[model samples]
Target: MNREELKALGLTDEQIDKVMAAHGKVVNSTKDKADKVEGLESQLEDYKTQLADRDTQLDDLSKQVKDNADLTAEIDRLKDENKTATADLQKKLETQAFDFALDKALTGAKVKNSKAIRGLLDMDTIKLDGETLKGLDDQLNGLKESDSYLFEQETEPTKPTIVNPGNPNGGTSTGDDDPFAAKLAKYN
Candidate 1:
């Protein structure tokens, strides 16, 4: 209230001044409290927004972690399969290479049995030179020299011929008039 109003209500000038001073203090204090409350509320809103953003980021990170784990497991399994396949392929190639080299070495060399010869030979001693066999030819030649009977030339047996009664001994006669003795003498 103003000084005139307080005076009309039968207050002295000094009392009116005192009441006005008290009222001004209360208004200022209330305004200060309200301003403080508004500031606090604004800060709370900002905190809530930040918390929501952080929660979203945490969820995204969790999802990414799970995906990474799954991918790692799949990669491990694929690596295992690749290792096994590589080993199998290498073994198959080695067998084919060995067979090819053996065939080349045994081409013209006579052997009683190719399988038996292969068994007698050692694969470790053989060396491959691109498309050719290095040590296998030498090994085969050594085998042929040591075992001549095993690598002998194949020959047909001769058949025995019947002797004629005209000749006492089996000998080549020029004519029937020539004596068998003369044919035998020429040979002797």
Candidate 2:
């Protein structure tokens, strides 16, 4: 309990002094070690906070990347759709223009002589030769005759009488001879 009691209990003064010094040294060393540990713990806590912040930043970056990717994909899809729509509209416009050109050509041809009309309409048909050309000419002539007939029907209140000269048999003239041949011959 007391220093004197320990001394009286058979401890020597030298021994007690040595033990006290050693214990004091151990306590001091323990205190120093504890302070170092506390500093190390604080540093570890700081490192943990930094790691947590980095994780949050990484998560935010990942979300942004995902959003960007999604937006890019959507843009690509819309671009493709727009491209298809534009192509379709262009095709329709081209078809309408072609039809308008054909209609104008036919109307102009009708106003002029059948030969000149045939020449104008048959310009595209001239590219063919041999049987193909003949067939195309026949088809073009038929189209012209039909167009003329329709135009006459729309304009004339009375139908014109058909006069047959080529046919030996009593029949209306079919007008088989290419009426446009004379007009087209000038170009040839």
| 20-133 per-residue lDDT for model 2 (tens digits) | 785786578558656765665675566557556655655555556666877667655655665665567556545444433443344433443444554545455443232133
Clashing pairs in 2: 115-180
How much is the lDDT of residue 20 in candidate 1? 91
| Candidate 1 per-residue lDDT over residues 106-180, each given as its tens digit | 644756567778877777988777777777877787887787666747676333343547756656655666797
Best model number under TM-score: 1
For model 2, the stretches where C-alpha displacement exceeds 4 angstroms are 1-67, 111-138, 145-148, 151-188
True-structure RMSD, every candidate? 55.4, 54.2
The candidate maximizing lDDT is 1
